[model samples]
Target: MSKLKNIFVFFGPPGSGKGTLAWLCVKRLGFVQLSTGSLFRRHINEQTDIGKQIDFTIRSGKLVEDSVVSKIVTEWLENAAHEHSSIILDGYPRTKNQAETLSQFLSEKFSSVKVCIVRLQISDEKLVERLGKRVVCAEKSCQKVYSLIENSSHKPKQTGTCDICVGKLIQRKDDAPEAVKKRLAVYHSHENELIDFYGENGVTIEDFNAADLVERIFEKFLCRFGFSIR
Candidate 1:
């Protein structure tokens, strides 16, 4: 209930269910979820000025310049601060430099931003299987996700459109085996260093099994962050 805003960074390898849990936390805790991947994709799909720039950046296999990424995120944060007390950032700060920039930005914006880092821990084998079978909606507003292998409980309806936005579901270009391996290589190169940076900054890093039951994951999140359902 503190007026001080909270910022949570969800950390995990691909197929760790970080997005799923992040969405749950956002709904239950009223936190705005900011995802770098989703943001970039949104822009690209919209073909906005910024999105066009990002498309070029991605095609070259180069990181989006920090200035561009920071500008977009800062604008969103400034707007959210006026209406919400906290925000959840997923799939961001993949590098130490980005993490440092975010830390400085928050320190300047809020009196004391409570930063929490949650690392979803799952076996590599499991992650590979899960991500390989994952399906993502192509639509921006209706980016409903489905797992063809592990998500037996939530089956995709016969309709090719997402239930939420009627957007067509499609396999991401990077979801293929070779692409996934390349991404994993890139992630491993910097993820540990980024994790260390946050830990050194006093960000709480909690490990949880993302492959567990939904209720169990929810309980773990609440227990670690000391939030309760209304």
Candidate 2:
């Protein structure tokens, strides 16, 4: 069996471009991205009982219950750890308790793997602007995210249409400006505590300023890790 190399934990609030950064790694570095948001979206799209619950919580700008989040993440990690050599974890461990739980689980199941915690730092003002302009494909299977901001590289070829699947684009309920502010508030409350927990556990947290272009961020990421696609 192939051993997992690095499990990248991407830390950032909503609209910080974590998904875009994850996509760049997937495209250029052949890493598998396990996005909790995408997983929740799948459940929500299916309208499962849990999906309904998650949908309600998300629409109200609240975090899903920790028990629900942990169960979903644990199941994902069980399969992904065995199948993928490298993985990027997007939006999983949001709070210090979740981080502690994840740390214990990884030690027990995949102790050999390296955990790389990267925190994307950006201003709340920038995040609000970004979220306000963000749109996603309406099709659940092709929920490609796009930015309507004039200077953003994630824009689709045609307005209001997905480039890959031609699905209609719409802003997510959680992406509303007011909802974004609420999400950011919740994030800031636990952000420092989560960082401190990792530090106390002897883990290094890599911080990156996310105001730069995606391409530039990708370049800096590679240089920091000295990673090569080839």
Candidate 3:
């Protein structure tokens, strides 16, 4: 088995099952998730320095400056080193500049620079529907996600609490109908350029159904790491 650490980068729109898939992957496999969206929310919600710095940018329906996003992600990854050997990255590297920054950082951090970059391709209609009713765990460590509009498999036992942790579940700001529209529009604008940037860096990219079952999605995601979900 390869001992080198692996970073799985997942690209998807707000409600394209990216978070649910990340949660599923972490549950089934040993990998931890490093979600930019989660980080941003924590920052903004807490009104921390970095969160305050990027709050306006996010609320304006624009991408946060690459420097701010990159710095936050780098700090998170650096701190996560001792806790997890594998990481599933979601919501970072939305732009080519961020991709370049990540490429350089990953090259230095891991023995092999090759990464499994997965893109969950979904339609705009589906994304809106999914985010409109998406439920997220309030607990930081427990990111169990469910979409009431879709994915019957991940519905929690309680009305508004996580099935596992019993944490309160809330809809993400970006998951609101209006926010979904803005985020999706931004996604479409930058998706292709990011793909091209990744291709130029020579990382392997995989495309999957954005609407697949959580278990099935992670099954394929784990395959890239030579892992299987039980």
Ranking by TM-score: 1, 2, 3
Clashing pairs for predicted structure model 1, backbone only: none
Give one digit per residue, the lDDT tens place, for model 2 in 1-230. 64577988888877676778999999988889887888889899999888899999999999799878887788788887767888998766877778888999889888888888888999999999888899999999999989899967788899999999999999998989889899999898878788888888888788888888767788889999888767
- What is the C-alpha lDDT profile of model 1 across 190-228, one tens digit per residue? 779988898788778878887786568879889877889
Q: Give the Å shift of residue 43 in candidate 1.
A: 7.0
On TM-score, the leading prediction is 1
Q: Write down the worst ten-residue block by lDDT for model 3.
A: 146-155
Error of 1 at 19 (Å): 1.1
Candidate 2: worst-modelled 10 consecutive residues by lDDT: 1-10
lDDT of 1 at 164: 69
Query: Which pairs clash (backbone N, Cα, C closer than 3 Å) in model 2?
Result: none
Tens digit of lDDT per residue, candidate 3, span 48-147? 9999888988778897888999999988887776677678777777778888898888777755635778889888987787667779999999988875
Candidate that beats the other on lDDT, 1 or 2, i.e. the better one: 2
Task: Provide TM-scores for the models.
Answer: 0.75, 0.73, 0.68
What is the Cα-based lDDT of residue 148 in candidate 2?
96
